[model samples]
Target: MTAHQNGNISAEVSDFLLNCFARSPGWQLWLSLPLSLFLLLAMGANTTLLITIWLEASLHEPMYYLLSIITLLDLVLCLTVIPKVLAIFWFDLRSISFFACFLQMYIMNCFYAMESCTFMIMAYDLYVAICHPLRYTSIITEQFVIKAVIFILARNVLPILPIPILSAQLHYCGRNAIENCICTNMSVSRLSSDDVTINRLYQFIGGWIMLGSDLILIFLSYTFILRAVLKLKAEGAVAKALSTCGSHFILLLFFSTILLVFVFTLVAKKKVSSDVTVLLNVLHHVIPAALNPIIYGVRTQEIKQGIQRLFMKGW
Candidate 1:
């Protein structure tokens, strides 16, 4: 009946019971309210942004195209993780089939990596616009966008395909309880009866490579952008240049900070409570998704005008 003894006999785990915020069951119902609100806001804001972009011909430029990709990724990421979390909170439905769990894990990993890569691309776009203004149009043309999209999809999806496959091959045995909201590779792999060294190592190494490189490139892009902006002799040029990148920097900072906090909390697990870690992990997904469209809508004038036009037409 014990976990190890059960594991010794069988290697197949049909389903998994997610241990989603089990410590404070009383607060879960109340917690679901805000989480549900975040999900609703993320879906609504991103959808409106997408629709506005689609309907407005003026917004068909390369920058908006990249924004559209970000919007779609946010929508997909939110859809992948939030509904199941809501179900766990509201109905106490935490059981997920082995296959479904792996699928969710795959989607989460792939979309998150895609989102990070997209942010790097967006930073590069900003750099080219600010640093190499003359070449911006020619460099970031439709063809270039198409190529970048292909790279994003291939780079993120291909490497992540093996994650779920490797996880599926593991001997899960009777340890079916996962100690988090989503079906992350680490969380599920921890339940395996077989050695999880490879899984842990892969996740650690892959995450650092993907996210680390993107962050470094994004930082370098902004560095050059800052250098270019500083060279302007015009009086208001600095403010104008900063304003253009303000929203992007804000969102990027929030995105990176929350992720860093989650990683640090995981490292300092003894100092942090499980509930706090779980809350951080859950919020990192939805909070960015909810705020991204709103930031771009309010900060970017083109998007604002597009929204107005969309509403006027609707009326």
Candidate 2:
């Protein structure tokens, strides 16, 4: 019931978990303000996109519907991390409870998995539109689309449950600095007092499946897309095709780099000055969450015009 004498950490990971970070940069909330401002901007843009899709019957088609879902995912993606991250910085509440830390990690990963699935679906959607244009309607019907969404949602739910459960068993002896700003799996695993060989292995294994695999598939999808784009009969169609896939591809690259860096930085011994890696790791995460909506919203024309129209109508 009481905190471990040395702070309730496991005998094996006691030192590893303790004092890895100094209370965290949660106080950087002041610094996080600029990032928050960016998220706010995204929130507005994504909200408009959602509203426009719902209001316009023409936009109710599968493509727009999926776009709206992605927008919602993007919106939640930012909200889940940024607000809590900012709060930690703003209110000086950086120390997350073991329970709370596990929870944050779970929620964050849940959305991340969702992003992976969304990206996959987006790829398939493009595949159908480009590879088989004539059959697109029948192939990607409403029922089919709903099934895809459900499948992705299910995928997101399953892996995350084990993370928190396995983590709950770890005991923290004192070293709980939490290397990265948030309680990422890599950093948290390093703090284990118990035999973490399995944990480490699992981290590496999961990274390949969950993170690495997603990146590979995304690239493959784009390869097909680029091939299709080249064969397009008209310049305008090709341009439009590139425009659509380009944004998702760029974001995919962003995630692939940052996430791997985070994984490596965590697994690597701290013999070298890891501050740079840690910073990169945080930026990798924060930037993507902050930039997803902005990048997509700015790049997508309909979203841009819709935002202008939404507020303009109120005026």
Top lDDT model: 1
Ten contiguous residues minimizing lDDT sum, candidate 1: 1-10
lDDT string for model 1 (170-208, tens) is 887767788888888878888887887887778778988
Point to the candidate with the largest TM-score. 1
lDDT of each: 0.86, 0.66
Residue 147 lDDT, candidate 1, scale 0-100: 91
Query: How far off is residue 165 in model 2, in Å?
Result: 1.2
lDDT of 1 at 100: 90
Q: Per-residue lDDT for 228 in model 1?
A: 93
lDDT score at residue 218, model 2, on the 0-100 scale: 66
Please give the clash total of every predicted structure, in order: 0, 18
